[model samples]
Target chain A: MLVNVLNVISQWAIPLLLLIIPLYGFIKKVPVYEKFVEGAEEGFRTAVRIIPFLVGMMVAISVFRASGAMMVLGSLLKPITDLIAAPAEIMPLAIMRPLSGSAVLGMAAELMKFHGPDSFIGRLASIMQGTTDTTFFVLTVYFGSIGVTRYRYSVVSGLSADITGFLVSLYLCHRLFG
Target chain B: MLNLIWLFLLVSGILVAAWHGNIEVVTSAALQAARDAVEVCLNLVGIMALWLGIMKIAESGGLVNALARLLRPLMVWLFPSVPPDHPAMGAIILNLSANVLGLGNAATPFGMKAMQHLDQINPRPGVASEAMCTFLAMNTSCITLLPATIIGVRASFNSANPTEIVGPCILATASAMVVGMSVDYWFRRRNRRRRR
Candidate 1:
């Protein structure tokens, strides 16, 4: 029941916002069209500016992935997963969650497909995927956009969040579905 | 920091690929990712323009301010460095809202706008501000209400109850947000003390 409501809300949200923002602005006597064009003028420049930073970040991440580093890392961390009695299957998803959003989603889908979405591993993967943002991507894009190279504790805090999210997902899934 | 991570990723990746005898794969991946980066930016230009333009109308109409006002108390607490009436506050609020609503595409433009606004007041050119760090901490683990994509994926797999994970997802993300905010607070205080 709640999911249905949420689905409806998500479906209607963007359309409603798109209509309402402009309608309200127009009602408030704002020069909506001109303002929009003026604001949009910065878009190209901003996108272009992000190219170098994005390329650098993406190449590093791609190289890491293509090197099978995750598999190596997964085996290295096997003892910890074994110690905690957590399913080893979602480790790759957990590790990739912070690094790349699309890659992690693909992992989650694959997990769900192999294990069945209603199974413990599948449900855990689903929750895990939902609970954390792509930390590297966000940090790269946002800071990169503003040319802020010295991010200081942003990364520390971001990784902490990712770790916390993963642990909490594991705990919740175990308690609720394990 | 970022410099170290970048170097580590590059060096370690090549070394690992060499160890695994797959150095060629890493080479292609690097080249492919570089091109994909530009492609990704090109894709973002359209939505960025559309949302930014609409955001301009919203700002000019005073709607952004109005929305910001509604979240003033919370915004003030989370971002003590930013004035309540600042454009950054409104952009931050809009960005968070888009994120909670699971409008990923819409969220990026507003987030970039927020970063720009935050940058305008930053004292240092290349260093991130306290507010920026806090904002990022909150953003990276923001409370996710919909988790729409996950649900859709589960449904596609013919799960008996695809939404079963919704409640768990919310609880987990909320916990992450709390931890993220607390860590941000701790870092902010530590940095302040160090500077003193």
Candidate 2:
């Protein structure tokens, strides 16, 4: 019952923001249309600017997958992940989650379709996706747009965080849902 | 770091494919990935344009500033290099707020704008500033209050309890945020000490 209520609230949060922000802006007499067009124009330019970076990362990801490296790596990591009680099946999803959101989403959906969402592996995949961000995608798009080539320590920190999120998802899934 | 990763991916991919006599797979994957990249960007353009437009109205109406002021204390601490009232601070606050609400599409525009604003005040044009790294760390481990996308997927899959993972998701992401911020803080202090 409480979960239902929370879920409903969460569902409405974004819609409410979408409604309220604009409504509030209009009430305040802001030139909403003009400003929106200006920002949207910038957004268009940014979208174009990021195409090269997106292609580079996506190609790398596809190459990694097509070469069977992901499968090889997954198999290699299976024993370790199993030892930690993390489902070996979703190992690829976890690895790809920080790389490409769409790819990982596809993987997660496949896992759920195969295992059923209520299954342990499916739940774990969902939690993993929820808890982590596509670190490389964000880094590439945001930094690449502005031509900030020297990311320096950002990647380290971002990946470390992803690792932390992944582990925590595993541990939590086992403890709470197992 | 990105360079090394990209290089590693390409070299390992090609070498492994060659060893496996699956060179054909590599060629197809590259072509497919290129197509997928364009599709992803096209999708992004529509979402980004819509949200950025909404955000522009919010910005002009001072809603973003109000939100930023509310987040001022936290922002001041997290991004010490940025001024409290700077447009970057507002953008960061808006980005984070959007992320927390599971508005991923909405968050990107604000995040990109934040980076631009941060760049405006950046002393080094091509290099990421300390604040940028910290912001990236925070964003990568963004504390998600609701994993709505996951819930929707679960619902579609007919999960008995689609929302059951919410509590765990929140807990896990919170821990990630804590860990990420600490590491970022440690790196920043170390860099400062080295310069000193």
User: Top TM-score: which candidate number?
Assistant: 1
Model 2, C-alpha of B55: deviation from truth (Å): 1.3
DockQ leader: 1
lDDT per residue (tens digit) for residues A10-51 in model 2? 778778877997888889998778888988898888888889
Candidate 2 chain B least-lDDT 10 residues: B97-106
Q: Record all residue pairs in model 2 with backbone atoms less than 3 Å apart, i.e. clashing.
A: none
The parts of candidate 2 lying over 4 Å away from their true place are A1-15
Candidate 1 lDDT score at position A120: 90
> Model 2 misses residue B174 by how many Å?
0.7
lDDT of 2 by residue, B67-142 (tens): 8898889889889999899999988988898788787888898899999999999999999999999999999999
Q: Against the hidden reference, what TM-scores do the models get?
A: 0.97, 0.95
- lDDT (Cα, tens digit) per residue for candidate 1, span A18-85: 89989998899998899999889776577777888889989998898889887778889999988876
Instruction: Count clashing pairs, candidate 2.
Output: 0
